[model samples]
Target: MTPFTSRIYLLRHGEIVEQDVLAGGTDLLLSDVGFSQLSQACKYLTDVELVQSSTLKRCSEFATQFSHNHQIPLLLTDDIREFNFGDWDGRKYDELWELTHSPSIGDFWQSPWLVTPPCGENMADFYQRVFLWWQRLLMNIVNNHTHKQLVITHAGVIKQLLGIICELPKESNQQNMFAVGYGKFVCVEIYIDNMGKAWPKIVF
Candidate 1:
């Protein structure tokens, strides 16, 4: 077996106007500042061969525009959508805090895996789905000899991917949190061995 190198650029969408509102899975578009942020960051992208994004407009809007501008093939999938807040989708955190009165909201921030929002996606299921999508993405790039691929997605998705690549513990410990900010990106390089095993290295 021959070894190869592939890069995946994990991009978090830009700032949204509704930052205060918990907008998970709400289909909110980017703010003007958000668009401007992404536009400035686009200068760093070079030699990108493929582009992918969440089906949500906030992510897909920028991905579509960037892919079209660069003339790269773009794929929109829901696999990378943010963790569904469910009933708490549009509510503000302070309101939920007052209603619950258990500091569950605060606890959730510290240990999301241990605390799930009402009717929201549990950490286990969210991890499973996102990891499944990530594996498929890696295999696709390796088989196709794709050198560089950009993925526009949510912060939760990015953090989970980072945890997987970094071999972080499954527990929701605040110290272990890997946060990716809006309009920012993390690059990982996939390394294939002679036996066809693939490992990832955080490049940028």
Candidate 2:
């Protein structure tokens, strides 16, 4: 394969009012504060030719609005949805703590690969899914010579994407890994070397 360069802007969704609840996989809309957060984030974006987002309502809503206003191509898919909390979806943090009588969920947050919500997608599988989609996106960027692509996704997906690009090992703790605050964005530059190996660098 020929060498190529691609720049990706990874963005996390804005703040949600129900911060104390585990809303993964839930189809909640963005709150007014969240919209304000997104508005502030828009000031920092530049040269975004294409945008992709998780089809979940919170992400897709903003993505739709942005693409329409900026005249950028948009792609929404489930490939980047937040980690599935399954039965834990929509549950409150304090209530779960009282019921479990321990901070097992917090432990899961620290080392997701070792603990999973009941009936939820395990970290390993989630990693594979996100990595696979990333590979596809890389191919598209290299083939089409696309520059400045934006991805609006959940924090978990963003972290895993960074882990894959950084080539982190399986045992690495994802919860303690990369974190992006609400409505914030991180930029990375990916370059394919002479040997067709991909290298990534954080670019502000």
Candidate 3:
């Protein structure tokens, strides 16, 4: 029996106006350069059969346009939005780094699972939410027999999903290895055997 194959493109949205800020909750739209980046990154995405996106404007705007242009079905969801930064939601990174807080931005990056930002979503809870969302997503994909799907989301979400697929430690600090720049897409290929088991690999 032939194994079933699925390809999912985890695309990070393009740059925003305040490129240096943690504006996940601010919902800032992408800049012109950012739109260009997103478009160019998706130039070769003709094979995608479906498109999913974070409800945030930065990702959804482009996802809508891509879906319309490519004639693919589009879905907007909140489960895959960026990690809530709370008080740091709309602040610049440099500003946050200069804070006198105990667990500063640097501290969080070094040990995200252990450090919860000021009034922000707990890293553990965030991880669990994304993980659950991912599980449901894969099941849906397999059940629907989808060949290819595109997901437009944030850097943190993509990194978390990648870590899940690789079974990496939460302290792995995937930013160093992934370095998913704005408008970049991490290609993942999933293989399901006839025995009803699934294996996922990061193709890029």
Candidate 4:
């Protein structure tokens, strides 16, 4: 079946005030270095008619600048915010690991479905919310007049979306596989076929 296609830029937030932390749902603002990285991304962005960002400051701060500068529309939503790390949120990796040795970080990554973080978000729930948001995105854009969109979110969100687009297994380590750096953007070309199935491809 024939399909209509559009592009969406998925961007990860830049460096934050608290460095070397888990940083999920921490609500930390961008560091100087982080803001610079986003400035570079801004120069690269073109033909983007709309901007959407996580409610978190690191993402919303830059998105606000981009939208205002380019006079494009902007939407802030919690659906695309980083997965909440719960008790481990905003803690240093080494410190948190040493502090709470019950659930090994290594084990969690290897088998997230089995090893749940201490009061942290389980992998399954994170996956559900992200994919559901994606479905809604496709539904919203499928029938509307053409508009290019940009999404500013966290590393986890970007990685999950990549896994979905590439059809990768849930057991794989998306963090290492995708390895999206701060301020980098992945251009995903999305097509909704006549049957309303969505197909996505990363355009780098």
After superposition on all C-alphas, the RMSD of every candidate to the true structure, in Å, is 2.0, 2.3, 1.7, 2.0
The whole-model C-alpha lDDT of candidate 4 against the native structure comes to 0.85
lDDT of 2 by residue, 24-132 (tens): 8988888889878887887768788899999998889989999999899999999999989877788898876655623367667777788877777888888888989
- Model 1 global lDDT (CA atoms, 0 to 1): 0.83
lDDT of every model, 2 decimals: 0.83, 0.82, 0.87, 0.85
- Candidate 3 least-lDDT 10 residues: 170-179
Per-residue lDDT of model 4, residues 13-38, tens digit only: 88899988999888999999999999
Looking at model 4, which ten-residue stretch has the lowest summed lDDT?
A: 169-178
What is the lDDT for 67 in model 3? 96
lDDT of 1 at 151: 91
Q: Candidates' TM-scores?
A: 0.91, 0.89, 0.93, 0.90
List candidate 1 stretches off by more than 4 Å.
101-103, 174-176
Residue 122 lDDT in model 3? 84
Model 3 agreement with the true structure over 97-170: per-residue lDDT tens digits: 89986878888878877888888998888788889988988888677778899999999899889889988886
User: Which has the greatest lDDT?
Assistant: 3
Predicted candidate 1: what Cα RMSD to the true structure?
2.0
Largest TM-score belongs to which candidate? 3
Model 1, 56-85: lDDT tens digits are 998899889999998999999988999897
In candidate 2, which residue pairs get closer than 3 Å at backbone N, Cα or C atoms, i.e. clash? none
Sort by lDDT, best first: what order?
A: 3, 4, 1, 2
Better of 1 and 4 by lDDT: 4
